[model samples]
Target: MTPQNPNLARELSLLLALATLWGSSYTFIKIGVETIPPVTLIAARTLIAGAILLAVLRHRQVRLPSDRQTWRRFFLQACLNSVIPFTLIAWAEQSVDAGLAVILNSATPIFTFLLTVLITRHEQATTRKLFGVIAGLAGICLVIGVEAIGGLGESLMAQLAIIAATICYAGAAIFGKNFRGLDPAVPAAGSLISGAVILLPVSLVVDRPWELSPSAASILALLALSAFSTALAFAIYFRLVQTLGSVGTTSQAYLRVPIGVAIGIVFLGERLSSTAWIGLACVIAGVAAMTMPRRSEYRAAQSAGNR
Candidate 1:
């Protein structure tokens, strides 16, 4: 649950609202994919979201950043956040249940922590952080359990795909944190637009959305997926990043888990074992523990105050 605050409640409310928006999207995706192919669904979603963002940016005349360096940064950000993870998750969700897919996605921060340690020397991993990750991973394992007794059954590859997606999400998070100094809107728009350009042709070659039967409901769902979930989601996410630094902003992951579980139960009628419930609690606690400011950070703050 999002904690209440006087000044920050509005933002907390908005973050929770975004979580809900994303939470409900899994159901929409499940429905859309019934009649539509994953490639078509994703292509339509990405392009539509890109078009909407382009229109908004144009209306506001928010001149796109033209510097070569900014363009490079934008390109990498798009690859990490959209092109890679989006495709992996879209395909993975097709094989795995939505609830389980989200459980896997929650590993994004753990991957992010590992990636940051490798890529950024200053953001060294701490003992508590390391312990927290291990605990969180144990919690995830408990939720998924040692189902390996059942061979590649049907979803072995699918589960692996979701894990890959989480890894992509980790890379994206680190990329995002690195780009925090730039205009959030610039990279936000760039990512969608570039991603669409990258995926459009691939989608056509594979699913050929043109040949697929088109109907009003499917079209509307695709639109909502793009407009609300992809486009607006990024906009709100970037805003949160601007308002709250990386650590504070990522608190949304903890919130998204329960919301996803609730959505799964309400819409998909998915069941969660009591063990899974306990695992979920552990996951949240572990994440909270990992991300909370260390005593050293607070002590440094106090020293600055004294100075």
Candidate 2:
């Protein structure tokens, strides 16, 4: 694919949409976790989202693969993508500030890039991508405010947990490439169903969810988190994984920072500092650098278009 490919623009737009869904998820989670235990909350989230996706599949007359090998891969994707990371972030959010979580989680593209260079060799570690990684990280620091780092050392374990979750997300993005041949919804639904299987048992054992009474607000927040953030977001996520490649897809991590700040300003009457405006520009530039076609591909595309 090249810069002239129309799908490139559409995929990047979907990438931004994915970032927006996930950016808002932090607010939902904060509210939901107030009355629900982390394990139970995440379990319910996977359950509801998985069920919804399955219903959509049924409505479309699509069937999940019954092969043991495919199901096994789904289980692995679930562990990396949802079960472990979701639980860690949920638990860590109890102690870690949201700013710290945003910064740490936004490191996914960096990790994904490194893993590709060192291990998978699945994608090129181009100069543009490296610049994107650095610029995006710097932009996140500015957008979230430099002062947010002051609380970093205070919540030692919680911060570490969030970092661990970020690592898991990177791994999941790389691993997700294995399902490129399947429809995006297949892996999205399969992984969530697998996540539900793993988490529901743990929720029963650890949280005893039946005895808990969650507030209406928390329940509503969980519902939104599950439906929009998990189900819809994952579907978009898998599609990007196929269309954009892992590093390109995870660029949404950087995009999420600005989107989160924009959401705050719009809905919560929060204001941005001058640095944040600069950061937003950096984010847009970085995403463009990372997602734009290579110069050679661009030249080739232009030549082909003229033919």
Candidate 3:
């Protein structure tokens, strides 16, 4: 099968949608975790999201992959992409502020770039791409402010957990390349199902969710988290990885910082500092640079120009 070429407009829209979906997830997690344990919250999120995706698959008559190797890959993807990161973020947020969490999570692209260079070789290392990653990270620090990094030393374990989650996210993006030809939803559904399988038993033993009573608000937050943030977001994420490759997909990390800030400004009546506005601009520029055609593509275009 021919590689699916990236459509700038469509992919940008999807990226924005995904960033918004995920950026808002912190809010839901904060609300839900007030009454629900982290493990239980994660399990509920994945299980419900997995069920939703499976329902959609059945309606579309898309059979889940039956091959053992594909199933193994799906399980590994789930561990890296959802279970580990989601659990870590949820637990870390119990101790760390959401601002600090976002900052640490924003390091995903840097890890992704490093993995691509060292292990995957799925994306070539270019100076432009490296600069973009650095600029985007700098933009995140500006947008969130340097003060958020102050408590990093206090909550050493939580901070490290968040960073570890970012590494898993980077790995998942690269590992997901193996699913290029399959339906995007298949890998997404499979991953979520695998995450649910891994987390449910633990949640049952640890949280005993059935014995705990949760508030209506927490329940609704969990529902939204599962439906919008996990299921739908994962579907789009897999599609983006297939079309744009790992580095490009993980560039959404930069996009999430601005989106989160925008949400706060618009919905919570929060004001952005002058630094934040400038940082947002830098993020846009960095993402554009990162996603721009590579040197090979540029050279091919130049040669065609002469021809």
**The candidate that achieves the highest lDDT relative to the unseen native structure:** 2
lDDT of 3 by residue, 1-307 (tens): 1123435567778888988898888777877887999999999999999999999999999999999999999999999999999999999888876656777898899999998898777677888888889889888878987676566788899899999999999999899999988999999999999999999999989999889999999899899999999999999999988876788788888888877666666644645556998788788877877776755665664576566
lDDT of 2 by residue, 197-237 (tens): 99999999989998999999999989999999999999999
Instruction: Write down the lDDT of every candidate, Cα atoms only.
Output: 0.67, 0.86, 0.85
Ranked candidates, highest lDDT first: 2, 3, 1
Model 3: residue 240 alpha-carbon error in angstroms: 0.5
- When 1 and 3 are scored with lDDT, the better candidate is 3
By TM-score rank, best first, the candidates go 2, 3, 1
Measured by TM-score, how close is model 3 to the native structure?
0.92
> Each candidate's TM vs. the true structure?
0.80, 0.93, 0.92
Give the per-residue Cα lDDT of candidate 1 at 111.
Answer: 69
Per-candidate count of clashing residue pairs (backbone under 3 Å): 0, 0, 0
**Model 1 per-residue lDDT tens digits across residues 65-85:** 787887787778778777877
Q: Which stretches of candidate 1 lie over 4 Å from their true place?
A: 1-18, 59-61, 134-153, 214-217, 239-251, 275-280, 294-307
Model 3 regions more than 4 Å off:
1-6, 264-271, 294-307
**lDDT of candidate model 1 versus the reference:** 0.67
